[model samples]
Target chain A: MSTPSTSSAPAEAGPRDKHALAAAIARDVPDGAYVNLGIGQPTLVAEHLREGSGVVLHTENGMLNFGPVATGDDVDLDLTNAGKIPVTELPGAAYFHHADSFAMMRGGHLDVCVLGAFQVSANGDLANWHTGAPDAIPAVGGAMDLAIGAEQVWVMMTLFAKDGTAKIVPTCTYPLTGLACVDRVYTDLGTFELAASRGRADGAVVVRDLSGISLEELGGRLDVPVVLG
Target chain B: MSAASILASYADAVADVEDGATVLVGGFGMAGMPVELIDALIEQGAKDLVIVSNNAGNGDTGLAALLAAKRVRKVVCSFPRQSDSWVFDGLYRAGQIELEVVPQGNLAERMRAAGAGIGAFFCPTGVGTPLTEGKETRVIDGRTYALEYPIKGDVALIKAHRADTMGNLVYRKTARNFGPVMATAARTVIAQVSEVVPLGGLDPEVVVTPSIYVDRVVCPTAQES
Candidate 1:
């Protein structure tokens, strides 16, 4: 929402738009890697993948080697992503049932996965499934599996909540999805990496890139310890 | 011999469904949802059912309509809340229906364990999370895992792309989710396919589900085709 105007906006503004954030994360994806993009904002990474990158897309609903979004006659209700949107199949596309599909993840067959998170603790504990709010219907689709299964779990989200509260905190108040699972975070304002310690409260945050904020201001905003990568 | 009975009508297919049956309904959403069969089950008037699925319901149709009819007593699924799931949201808030949310992969693999005749398995999916609370936890090879049990169903209603007269089934793309596994996990498996081929019409190698797992087959769409 902090994206500046095309002509006068600073190259590195306060917060980049979702498209720019997606492009940055998509570029970070290694070549020839198998990746799963979570539903919602993370799904945009698929469209920005480099051409001929050989990046195979996996959907938890039972598909691999799937291509970008399908339009026109290419649309098939049966062929879709984890988000259940119409998608295309690559030449080496394969389809299995839900069991085999999740096996690809829980069996350590995936290279990376990008997920959205509500809160990420200093030690990389992720809490995205539920807010623990009253009258909330908690729905966790392959989050727990994907969190622990992927070789590297990258998060794509906003750095702060709408009320200006930092989501990257010393501890998370939401129900935990996975303990010490996140490796990196790509947000609207900045990017960060975590020296994650599983089951331990000692996590060191590293600021990899910054757009709109200074290191001092960012550190002041967050309660956790952070340093330059 | 295969126990697959070819039924002429979808309503007759689900007529024998008794009350309090734990049914596994297959689909990732609307892709492989057995809409006609569910409509038929609604007409069949079976009540107090436990529905197992990946999602509770999306819109006001298929499983949503089933929930709307006050037939389901509980839903055992991974994801029950979605933007279009107002019907389930209403029922859940009113405390009329009970819910058990499992992780998506665990939901699939649990049924797979049942189909494979495995007693129980240790999985790292929900380790140290609230989803695995009160369950047995083990340290295997230095990694933590929670003990998981199989989820067997009394009846499984699924949709497939094609099925042979012998009940060998194949599914289309992502729509194939939970169908093949549910077929084996259930005591009685019923399938609604778009096409019904002859016994030898389908190749054996590409068949996702063999005839041994299926109990019945119906093709209302084939008549339309």
Candidate 2:
């Protein structure tokens, strides 16, 4: 949905905070979808999803249909998400062996999976599990499985790293979690989709929504070029 | 029926584990950790152990205590680092311990394969990632997958809510994670349960882990301050 503009007006401000970005992403999730929220920022998507949305949340730890963060006497130390935060089991929730839970993951039973990314390439290559630091111990965890197994992979992360470097890169220097698996990028700055071009190996990133930054200003901030929707 | 699998003490349950033994510790964080068995292992002070678990540990107990005591040589796990996993982080940063980070799905499948008598399986989980490096890759039905090997353990330390004298176990809620599968993958399985009941007391339909897989069952005593 686009608003036709006769004159060049600055695009509206992008998402102001992480919560806004998470809400932006949550609005796009369809009803009755089986979704897995990765650890970290992606976990917040659960809190922002439209109430009674019929979205079934899957945790790699072996529970499904768990409710939001547990509080007071509702907290069960054993019942937790992949992030190890206490959660409540909703009515009709089911538990299974770890293998069966993973089977649900690796068998493509999930409709969508929201993940956190360190760097996402123009061609949708994902690098999240490791930073490629010499002294850093690379922990793959369940990220690799969720990235490749889900039907659509949505990455929720800040547009830039703490050092002011663009996380959306022309090519990733970090170790990859999956090759060309990311479907959309949800950031505090804006939301983007990967647009592949003919005869080009690396595709272009098209901004579908803006928060506070204009197209030209957003392009000026990055090393790579970005297209406006 | 044969003799009951009940053991008199936690120490006796874990007595056969030796130096450099590979152990599968079942839990998804602190939920199903065999706390009593871990305490016994800590008291026993076995060294150079290789552990396979979902996480390193929470706070300073269970696997963390063993690791803090410098008893573990390596850890093959899915998620080894957590906010409360300072013990593992310290040991890992110091280069005192080795780490093998496997994808959670791959880790679970490998353990299941060990118990199921399967040699290896092709899984697409880690393909196109650094985890796939040095591993065999094959294209099946136009999709690339990595060949993962089964992971067997010398002993498995598991937790359950209840166990029958015959060693059949029943787990509770999400605490059941990895316990039943680990039992099948190990040469010896020692389960710490809250209660032990007579063989016929437990319903046959509800047994999560069959009696054939468990070697010893121990009920943890009340903790002393």
Candidate 3:
């Protein structure tokens, strides 16, 4: 099994930081898309979307066109995202009852939803809610709804776990949140497009990568083979 | 107009709740939770209670206080394990408290379905996950959906910004989460509002919940207590 390089430093700054990866994902979100940014790294996508981009942000708590994180007096304890962090409401923001807001989610009205993941199988199965650890407290928020409800499901996460385990595996060992739902996986290493193929549940191809990392190096870090396209 | 539904005190407002009753406590995290009502329930000391909400609570406040007080036997919610939900974490790990995690959308729809008198609905959410295990499934127009049942409560504890003497309610921004739907799904709806105005003080267009659903109203002290 190939291991992540242990070099202390690289000559150039690679796409290893969260903000850079977030920006990379933000660039692909089309204008006029009604998007739901899931908790954790997916929430960072809101800060990266172009200011004038017509991407309307939806929070399951019942707000549309919700703004960036709030600071100082702007913080309204009641105005928050799924992560329960205070957020400002943008101009033309509308609030509705929680059930109505979720109708927009589960009714397949959302265009795109970006979520974080613990494991993503080659066939696009997603597992992020629980690790099934005996002591772990599992909470399945709106992730299950967004994973299967949106027109497109995009996942934002690191390529590997802290223990050097590949998150994009041939099959998920963790409990699944949805099956055959993830369309693309964006990681600090690069972006991979998952496609349905014969004889394979799903085939992943690296569409973009950092300058410092080659396709061969990226492929070596995962248990499953990823092609460079 | 009919007699005011206003209750004299918090204790009187929640006096009807009994042990093992399923209650829908409205809120999204700590935002719109009926803190005063929860405190009353804690004081009432009803045991084996089933709580339905978006979250357990942020910290040692709201539903967390009730759980910390050992008044809750089970929690049916979408997000129960928040960062500050140590009280629930302790009880859950010790096998003292039971949890039924639902997707946020599904949770809301189930409550709404109950209020609307819908028997059951097929939803695309949780189609192939463990949430669908042992549940009925159907294929409509070549798309698979899991059958979900309506969720009704014995009582609903709701928080609103204001209510008319007649019990029509208006919510404040995102704090309105779950209040309107829970109001209709419960046998008795008890609303804790910050202000109560005369009938007609609220515009019909702005009223989120009509008076027909509310059974009682109370204005607790300004503090969360």
Model 1 clash pairs are none
Q: A-chain TM-score per prediction?
A: 0.91, 0.89, 0.88
Per-prediction interface RMSD? 0.7, 1.1, 0.9
- Two-way lDDT contest, 1 vs 2, winner: 1
**Compared with the true structure, what per-residue lDDT tens digits does model 3 show for residues B8-50?**
5889899979999999999998889999999999999899999
TM-score computed on alpha carbons, candidate 2: 0.92
> In order of the candidates, what TM-score does chain B achieve?
0.97, 0.95, 0.95
Q: Which ten residues in a row are the worst by lDDT in model 2 chain A?
A: A5-14
**For model 2, how does the per-residue alpha-carbon lDDT over A93-132 read when each residue is reduced to its tens digit?**
9988899888987788999999999999887889998888
Using lDDT as the measure, the top candidate is 1
Residue pairs that clash (backbone atoms under 3 angstroms), model 2: A13-A211, A13-A212, A14-A211, A14-A212
Badly placed stretches (over 4 Å) of model 3 are: A1-13, A195-206, B1-4, B220-225
Winner on DockQ (1 vs 3): 1
CAPRI quality band, candidate 1: high
In candidate 2 chain B, what residue range of length 10 has the lowest lDDT sum?
B216-225
Candidate 3 lDDT by residue in tens digits, A13-64: 5655777677777888998899999988888878788878889999988999
Cα error, candidate 1, residue A199 (Å): 11
